[model samples]
Target chain A: MKYITTVNGQEYIIEIDQKTEITVNGERHGVDFQQLAESGTLSLLIDNRSLEAIVEEREDAWEVLLHGELYAVHVQDERAYRLAQARGKLSDASEAVVIRSPMPGLILDVLVEEGAHIGQGQTVVILESMKMENELRAGRDGVVTRVHVGKGDSVEKNQELIAIGDAEEIKEQQ
Target chain B: MDNLLIQKFDKVLIANRGEIAVRIQRACHKLGLQTIAVYSDADRNALHVRYADEAYNIGPPPATESYLVIDRLIDVAKKSGAEAVHPGYGFLAERADFAQACYDAGLVFIGPSPKAIAAMGDKQLARQTVRAAGVSVVPGTDPGLSDDELIAAAEKIGFPLLVKAAAGGGGKGMRPVHEAGSLSNALAGARREATAAFGDGTVYLEKMISDARHIEIQVLGDSQGNVIHLGERECSLQRRHQKVIEEAPSFVVDDELRRQMGEVAIAAARAVDYVNAGTVEFLVDRDKNFYFLEMNTRVQVEHPVTELVTGVDIVQEQLRVARGRRLRYLQDQVKLKGWAIECRINAEDPYHDFVPSTGTITAIGLPTGPGIRVDTGLYEGHTVTPYYDSMISKLICYGETRGEAVLRMRRALEEYRIMGVKTNIPFHQHMMESHRFLSGQFDTRFVEERFSMSEREIHDELEAAIFATLVAHQRSQRASQIVAPGERDTSNWKWYTRWERLQR
Candidate 1:
């Protein structure tokens, strides 16, 4: 089985075979799914040492407790995984991009017009939350493609607020 | 004599809110003084407001409209006919103008003289004054150092120095420069922070002493210029320059060293003509040499440890000093005994980068024993307001020795509990169990460097089990209480209604 894991915005492709041992980022580990189900624990061999991790099935995910660290892992079969991969490819080719709210807050001000040019790290939006004002900056130099929110808008964590794209990227899409 | 002393002023109006308000209220009641509390609209049911003989709403929730409005506070005092006002520790406590306003209004301000506060509040001037009084200070640029002069001074004093705001405290407006390459950037950063925090962009540079311990001398001064020190407190256990655990009579100090430090603190106080209670802090190195840090002109958060061992009511003494009283106890009469420790319990999630936790305190089980005391402003159903400091309580424990004190503190923590709002109590418990802390061999970076979630696997496992059990119980209860056809759903409807209420 192959899985894609994204950690801190970085992606890694991991493949696991039955009873096969693997080393990840310099740490050696052996994984056996069959043994895991029988013992209700997964035996992990790390750095030539053996450790046990408790695994439990929760709603739509597997809750794995390794050395007391709990991680909610969403597992998918081959068919569903392939569909997700296809969707990722389509999104990668699209010029329309979503900007995520960096933190939970009320949108106090939106500083850019729909077609305004924005330099990298330029403040485009101001958010007020927890009694502190934080400015959201442009991640890359680009023209403002669209504005999804307005002033006095209450937004949750990761809600889209703006869209930006380079002139070259937009022309290529057209 | 008794009749004359008790002529008037039975109730002391606490012109502040939060932990310090509760602290003053406790002290006032202990001294047979009634407490009158004033609050804003948001604090109608606050713990401090409830603990007073009378409560009145001043204004809205914002501090500028309420706490910092001197006229409103004075009006409340006058209306209530309260003679004295205890400003607690923050808000208006250290404001010299507020103190003067209280004096002009014929209300006793339970703190130092307005002159003393003004002199100490300016960090650069206070540094020069203390140094002139023969107190050793860190090698740094004096007052009125230009940017170019500051850079030159940094080069002379060497790298790894500190850039500090002259008008700031509380670990704000500070930057550490490790080398010449980072000097310009650090200075700019420090200046920006200074402006943002204190409305002052002026900063000063100092040689950052490596492996130094933070030890402060608690001093008491009277109207007659008599000042005495209450030994030294070891506040070396810090995170980001904020103290976590503080102990009195440091492990390094002997009788001779204590006497020397005490005399230096007294000299520093008298040099500024300081009156009332103040803390003269210092940075002590391994060679027994100490450099004066700064003079805190107001009451400190860690005053409980000093009071525990010395049997002195610092707040009451501050009131007496403001009333033109002489020193009640002479220098030779002061005696320190036992070991005392204080842990600042902040409403922060230790697992989540210590982010402030704001919510209602659903449940609380405070630690109580012969030697344990919790100075807190929170109650079981009180909301941990996001508009104020994250700190909710200060837990102090006293014993005959440091070892006993640590053991007692561990037990006290085990017995303590607070739900619905996250706290740093778990971190305190973990530190109390760490070998380095138990042996007193830790430094300022101990908490940051030593403890991690992965390092404490067993404790994490226990926590997981407890959380799992709690969740499972809630699920089971919900399943069992499912309403059948024709059955009333009163209790379950309450939960649903409450959730709907929050959404609305």
Candidate 2:
């Protein structure tokens, strides 16, 4: 069986086969899906010892409890997994782009029209929260293609504020 | 002083928010006092609002228009028909003018006298009053001393000294100077911080001890002028001057030392003619000698640890005291029972520079069973807002001895679970397992020196956890897909089929 895993925006391809035992990330394990189902548990061989974990499905993700510690993991389907791998390859070629909240706030002011020209680290929006003020800064010199939200908005964790594309790169693509 | 008694009222208006508000509401309910809560726009759905019998939104999110606005809070108090107002710990708790407003409005204020609050609110004046009461204070000049005068006083007090704001506490507006060369800079910084934090930059000087333990004596006073101390609590485990863990009965304090500290605390309280519940804090050194620090004229966050050991409901006592009742138990009658430990459960990511983590707590399983008490303002689905203190809950454990209490606390921490937001639970778990902490051989700088994870360590741990998660995720996916269809063939290739099934 072959599977692709994405963690923290990074992707990895893993292959498991019987009699072809291998260790991944320092944890040695023999792959046997039938044994795992019969025992109702999966055991990973780490340092010549077996460690068991109970996997449970929880609302669009799998929660694996290993040694009394729980980990939340989001799994991607085959199509999305392929796209994520492609995205990973493209990211390696381009300069890393990062977006930061301009202000320490609730992001009450996002003034950049999407697909607008923005300089590197330019102040794109203002965040007003906790009785203080902060400004959102752009990641790199690029053209904003999509604005995720507008004025007087509330954003959750990792909610997209804006999308940026390199002007020269977009021109070349067109 | 007229007898300010709380006439029989069904409900109390808690004109505050956060953990303290929830604390007061719990105390009120224990006494059969229903609570009315008032909140700002930002805190309309806060835990305190949900905990109260009734909640009203006063104004906008800014504190100036809501919590700090005396007129608005009074209006809410009136509309709710609440007979008394409990200011909890902060916001309006220390505001003498606000307390007087409550008095003038014919509503009972569940705290000390406004005059007492005013006297103690000014740090320097409180020191002088405590000194006059024969309580040994830190060797420092009174407020209004010139720089030259302060420098000379510092020399007399010795090279290492502290320049503190006369109107501030909580590590604010305080500077520790080691030598004469740093005096001017320290004084200037202290003044600026004092002005910004307390609105008054009047600075004072004190002898700074290189290693000091913060011990506070809890004092309860009645309107009839009776006051008594409920022993001491050692709160030296601090980070950035905020207490992280607090325990009752100092490790070095014996019966004699406890008596002396209690007497000084009582004297300090009596000097101000204080009423209700208050804490007289002190800085103690290795030799058992202690000096008066400052008087906190409101209920403290660590009040539950005291309640657990002494079996006294300090908040209920404050209400009873406000109602012109005498101390229910005498000073000698109050018995300090077994050890009690309180861990402040803050909504902070200990791995990330102790930064405040704000979000909804999706799942919460509080520790139950004997000897474990959780005083939390948050419930499942309660959003921890950035508008308040990071402390979401206080988990206290009590037992026959310190070891028993610590063991129980460790068990409680294991049983307790909070998800959907980053918390300091892991940090507490690490600290509880530390050798120094278990042995109680720690000081204020213990956490800073020992538990602080280096940048490299943080990166490594994050990478490892992420890798492990990804691997587990892949294994689970393969197993699920293989098990989707029921096809069992266990005849010829039993081991092969088992291995193949597990691989899925």
Candidate 3:
């Protein structure tokens, strides 16, 4: 099956056959890959050149530590890619976005209220995580349609905390 | 000479956490002394707690409520029957009050005398004391001067002066003024910063010594008035006011200068009647003129570099001195053998402005071999919390030559592995490969103001693209090998087997 892999803003088309032959970005290469049974180390021999990498599967992507640097890779199959494309269009058409927690933390305070218009970079919430206070800001000019969290609420990684709608769209909804 | 009665302690309590605490615990165990550890809520599962002979929970995660609280520390020491207290560098190491409390509690404080601590804890007083001892100090304003008086002092010091907090260390409340017009503003800013950082707005003035090397001397003094210096450590590599790398026997100091600085450092310690382990730091100029900086009243974080070169265990020496024994070596016996380098591995992202990274360390593989030592408080599945300093380990390497030491450090850094948190390993790797670093021509400002890491990232894009493709390809293979629902339920082989069974 062919896959679309995006790494650090660069996209590549990868095709694999029987786990031995692979082509990346239209260049065919004989690959010998094996996952160590005891250790999570990945051993790969691409075109007879050896490479060892530590691969960790995070929530949204695979984080590969190769040669002392971390690279985040996002992979999607054909069906999933098409589904994601559809969802992207829907979100773009509505012109609304949900602001979520970047990491697990307690809400120190909420800086915006429902129906409050906020400009890009305006503080929306103060999150205390890892013993440091981080200010979550509005990514775009919009009106806060709903606040899903309050002061002192415990939040998880990527948990949606606020809904932001276009200034005109929220008025229409109300 | 009053503490010469040979006060021996059976157990020592370490009033700190993380790698330093672990390091002290190892030293205590080596000397056959029992060690007791005190931890906050955040360090319940810490490596130090597990390494100690006994452990107690002092309080919550915040240092103020736990590590910095003299009362809590004393109570824990008492409850644990610890005969002495070792406040390893940071939390209360330099606090004179804490040392006095330990003395008042009838417990041996494994550091300099409280009087010595008090004398050197205040930078203003320390300068005066060192100067009286005939040790040259960086020309700075005296304490208790008003704003106008300070401005006048700055004028004499000339443009390019530093407004420093009298009670400050660790670069917290320092501002550099480059001209006469900005003196007042710089003073106000420094005052505000000092008030916030050290709770003292008292400011001082110092002529800024550009391109000076931060070379500090490690002094060990006994209660018998016998003080000796353990050479010097070059700690000029720094960022965000924290020393990231250190080495012993600076390239700039020759035999003649080493002897002079060593004698001056001993005099500085003797001026305060210091006892136990302490460090007298100095700033050395390009022309080899050394000026006293300050005296750390306890074991320092970079003490290992001195130990590796001098072949002395400083923590064990602290224990011995607190037990009223004289320093094992006299001035004539003290020797610097070889070169040593230390790199502090902190859980900070070098690519992202060194922001603190905290999480469970899912995996770790420390370097091992001859001439490489790793002092760390980490284990697999251990958590790196954000309540304390981000330093996770100190990797030190020693060799007969500076080139050998640097090469060994590069090899060790390459072998080190850590997962689930960002670290500054790449920064160390880059420094190891730099020509300036190899030549030993850098200052404290070299990291923050001058050094760049962009040149090291040239091959990252190509490597990342290839690795990503490989990972995707492997993942697809794994997915294909898993049996589907229809394939698991019925198979052509199974049907054929059933027909053959019926015909038979």
Predicted structure with the largest lDDT when compared to the true one: 3
Model 3 TM-score?
0.82
Q: What are the TM values for chain B, all candidates?
A: 0.88, 0.84, 0.90
Per-candidate clashes come to 0, 23, 0
Query: Once superposed on the true structure, which residue ranges of model 3 sit more than 4 Å away at CA?
Result: A28-30, A37-39, A47-50, A78-174, B1-7, B143-165, B173-205, B458-504
lDDT against the true structure, each candidate: 0.72, 0.73, 0.82
Number of the top-ranking candidate, with DockQ as the measure? 3
Per-residue lDDT tens digits of candidate 2, residues B1-504?
Answer: 244444456669998887788888888888888899998887777888888999998888666677878998889889988888998875678878989999999888889878999889877789889989998877777877888888878888887777887766666667767799999978876786566444568888888765678899999998777889898998988875678889997777788998999998988999988899999999888777899989999999899889989999998898777767788988889989999999998876675456567777666667899999998877766877666567788999998898898888888876676765667776776677777888877766677766654321112222223334445445545555555434643322243446577768
Q: What's the true lDDT of residue B430 in model 3?
A: 93
lDDT of 1 by residue, B244-287 (tens): 88998788889999999999999999987888899998998879
Worst 10 residues of 1 chain A by lDDT: A31-40
Ranking of models by TM-score:
3, 2, 1
> TM-score for the second chain in candidate 2?
0.84
The DockQ-derived docking category for candidate 1 is incorrect
On DockQ, the stronger of 2 and 3 is 3
